[model samples]
Target: MTKIAVLGAGSWGTALANTMAKNEQDVTIWSHKAEQAKEIALKKTNARYLPGASLDSNLKATDDMALAVQGADIVLLVVPTKAIRQVAKQLGTILEEKRQQVVLAHAAKGLEQKTHLRISQMIEAEIPAEFVTGLAVISGPSHAEDVVKGDLTAISIGSTDDAAARLLQAALANEHFRPYTNSDLVGSELGGALKNIIAIGSGMLIGKGYGANAQAALLTRGLVEIREVGKALGAEGETFLGLAGIGDLIVTGMSPNSRNYRAGVALASGKPLAQVEEEMGMVIEGVNTIKAVVDFEEEFDLDLPITRTLYQVIYEGKTIDQGINDLMTRPLKAED
Candidate 1:
C-alpha cells in the first residue's frame, strides 16, 4: 500500500484524502490546527470547507507535521500557494533528519506570490534533491466538492519526468477519477493558474448581469491572451488547446464551484477585495494571480487585455463597467 500524506485540511485536501482512502490507499491529512485535525479524525467530515461529504473511516488526519511526513512515501502538498514554500522547507528538514526520499506531488494551483514561479518550481527551490525522487502537479476541471460526491472528474498530471507522472496517474486513476499525463510543465501550471484569473472575470461579467454572449467572448479571448502568455513562458501553443489549457479554463471560468469566480461575484457586489477574501476564508488565487500577471506583463512587455483589465479593477479600484468599457473599446486589431 502506498502511504500518502496530504498537507492541509482545506476543501481540496479533505476531498482528495477521502478519495485516496476510498481507493484503499493509506492516506493521512495534516492540518495546522489541532482542532481541525481532531475534528476530521473523529467525525470523518470537514464541515468548514467540504460540507455534507463523508470521509473514509480509514483515513487519518493530524496536526503533527512530523507524523504526516516521517514515513510518507508520497507527500501531497495541498496547502495554499503562499504556504507551499514554508511547508516544503520544513518537509526538507524532516526528510533529511529521518533520511526519507519521497515523491512530491502538488495540487496547489498558483504561482509564488513574489517570484511568479510555478508551484513545482517553488517546491524544487525549497526541497532538497536528495529527499525528493521526483515531482509532479495535479490540475484540471475537477472541483473539490464534486470530486468528493463522486462526480466524474478528469484531471491531468504534468511533469518533465514521465515516470513520476505515471506513478501518480496509476495510483490516482479509478472509476470516478481519470488522470492523464503531459510532459509540458509550463502548459499545465499556466493553464491551472491563468484559468483562475479568467474565471474571476467571467464571474464579474455574471454579477454585472452581462449575457452569456459577453461571458463566452471573454472566455474565448481570454484563451487567446493566455496562449500568447504561455508561449512567451516557453509553453507550446498546442498545449493550450488541450485538457490542461482550454478544458480547465471552461470549467473554472464558468463553474459556480470555483472560488475565483465566486470572489469575482463578491467584488462585483461592491465588497472590498480584502473583505471578500477574508469572508471567503480561502486564498482567492485569481486576486493574487492578477498581481503576478501585472508584474510579469511589464517584465515581458505583453498585451493581456483581460488580465490587465481585471488587475485595474482589483488593484486600482476601477469599476466593473469601466473595466468592461476599456476592454470592449480597445483599438481595433485583427484576430491573430
Candidate 2:
C-alpha cells in the first residue's frame, strides 16, 4: 500500500494522511470542499481541522473523487456517518470505472441512521465485488488531535479477512501509533459506534455537575451494556476488553477533544441537538448514534437504559435531570 487515497479532510483524515505521508507512502487526501483541498495544496496546513500543525509536504490533496480513487491501492474512508453512503456510492462509481482491485478501509465510527449498517457493511453494499477486493475497519482510541501531536495512541483494525487487516496494520503502524489487529468486526464496529453514545453521556455528566464517581459508574455499567449488545449482535465476549471496545470507550467517553463529548456539554446546557452540532462545526456521531440505537432497541427488543435516557433528553424534549432520575431509580439487578 504505497498509493493511498484518504477520503475526507476532517481532523482524522488529515492526521492519518500526514502520518502515512511521513512514513513515505504516496498519499492524497480528498476533501468535498474545493477551497479546503486548495488550502491543503498551497498552504500545507489544514487549519480548520488541525490548527498550527504542519502537514507533510509530500501529502497530496484533491476535491476530485475520480482523481483521488483512480489507481490507488488503498482507500481510507474517514468521513462522518451521515456522509458515508454518498461518499461510498460516489467512490463505487469511480472504482467501477477502473480495473485495479483496491482494498477499502474505514476509520469512521458510527452506524448509518436508516439502514443501521456498519461502515464496512455500507461500503460493501455500495461497492461491488469486482472493484473492492478487501474490507477492513480501523477503530479504537486514536483521537485525531492526539495522533497528529505524535502522542502514543493504540488502536485496532478488525476484519473477517486477516490479509486485509494485516495490510492496513503494517501500513498504518508507526513508533507512536500502535495498530492492533482483531477479527471481530461486529464487536469492533459496534464498540466503536456505541462508545460515542456513552461519551456524550460522560460530557453531559460533567456539564450537569456530576462527579467522577458518576462517570465511573457510567463507564462500568456502560461497558456491560456494550458487551451485552455486542454479544446479542454475534460479537465475541472478549472483544469488549480489546482496543476496539473498552479502549475506544475510555478515550471517546473521557477526552475533551471528542466532538461527541463537547456536544454533550451543549446538550446539558439545554441546547437542541441541531444547534449543538451546528455550533460545534462538526458531526456529533453520538446524537445520530443514539437515534440508531433507539431504533435498534425497539426492533431487536433490547434494553439500553443509558442510551434510551439520552435519546429521551435529546429527541423527546425531556430534561436531563428527569432522564438521569429514571436511570437511577430503575430496578436493582445483578452485576451481570
Candidate 3:
C-alpha cells in the first residue's frame, strides 16, 4: 500500500484522509493538537471537523510531524493557505534529510494575503527545491461534508510535471470521486483562489432574496472578473472555462455548504463580518482572498469591478445596497 502523509486535521484534511483510508492506502494524518490526533486514533473519528464520519483503521493520526511523514511516498497538505508557509517551514526542519521520492499534493484554495503567492510557491520557498519532486493541486467542486458522504464528485489535479500529475490522477481517482489532470498550474490555482470571492457575492445575492436572473448576472460577471485577474497574472485564458474555473464557481456560488457563500449570506443579513466568521465556526477563505484580490487589482491596475465592490463592502463598511448600486451604475460594455 502507498504510504501518504496528510498535514492538518481540518474538515478538508480529515475528509481527504478518509478518502485515502477507504481506498486502502496507509494514511498518516498530522495534527497540531495532540488531543485531536488522539481522538482520531482512539475513536476512529474526527468528530470536531468531520462529525459522524468514521475513519478507516488504515488511517493513523499523529501529532509528530516526523512520524507522520516517515516513509511516506507523498505528502498531502490540506492546511489553510495562511498556514502553508509555517507548516512548510516546520516540515523542512523535519524532512530535510529524507531522500524518498515524495510528491507534494495540496488542497489549499487561496493565495497568500500580502505576497499574492500561491500555496505551491510558498511551499517551494520554505522547502529545499530538490526535495520537492513535483507540486500538484487537487481542486474543483468539492465540499468536505458531501465528499465524506461519498457523493459523486469530480475534481482536477493540476501540475506542471506531467509524470507527477499522472501519478496523482491514478492515486486519487475513484468511482465516486473522479480526478482529471491538467498542466496549467496557474489557471488551476487562480480558478480555485478567485472562485471563493465570487461565492461570497453569490451568497449575498441569495440572502437579499434576489431572483434567479440577478444571481445569473452575478455569476456571469464574477467569471469575467476572475478571467481578467487570471490573465493579468499570466494564466491561460481557456483554463478558467474548465473544471477548476467554471465548475468550482458554480458549485461554491450555489452550495450552502460553501463557507464563502455562507459568509456572504451572513453579510447580506446585516451581520458583521467578524461575527459571521464566529458563527460559521470555519475559515471563510473568501474573506482573505478578497484582500488578496484587492491587492492584486491595485498592483496590476486591472479593473475588477465586482471584486472592488466586495472590497468596499468587506473593508470600507459600505452597505450592501450601496455596493450593489455602485456596481449597477458602472458604465456598461459588450460581453466578451
Alpha-carbon error at 87 in model 2, in Å? 1.2
lDDT by residue (134-198, candidate 2, tens digit) is 78888889888888889998889888888888877777788988899989888889999999999
Tell me which residue pairs clash in candidate 1: none
Estimate the TM-score of every prediction.
Answer: 0.97, 0.97, 0.97
Q: Once model 1 is optimally superposed onto the true structure by TM-score, how far is the C-alpha of residue 31 displaced, in angstroms?
A: 0.9
Off by over 4 Å in 1: none
Ranking according to lDDT, highest score first: 1, 3, 2
- Name the lDDT of candidate 1: 0.89
lDDT of 2: 0.88
Give one digit per residue, the lDDT tens place, for model 3 in 139-251: 88898888888999899988999888877676666788888989888889999999999999999999998978988899888999999899998888888888899999999
Write candidate 1's Cα lDDT for 1-336 as tens digits: 788999989999888888888888888999999999998999998989988888889899999888988788889999999999999898888888899999899998888887899998888898889888889888888899999999999999888888888877877888999999999888888988888999999999999999899989999999998898888889888888888889999998999899999988888998898899899888988788778877778888988889999998988888999999999999999987
Q: What are the root-mean-square deviations of the candidates from the true structure over C-alphas?
A: 1.2, 1.3, 1.2
The CA root-mean-square deviation of candidate 3, after full C-alpha superposition on the true structure, stands at 1.2
TM-score of 1: 0.97
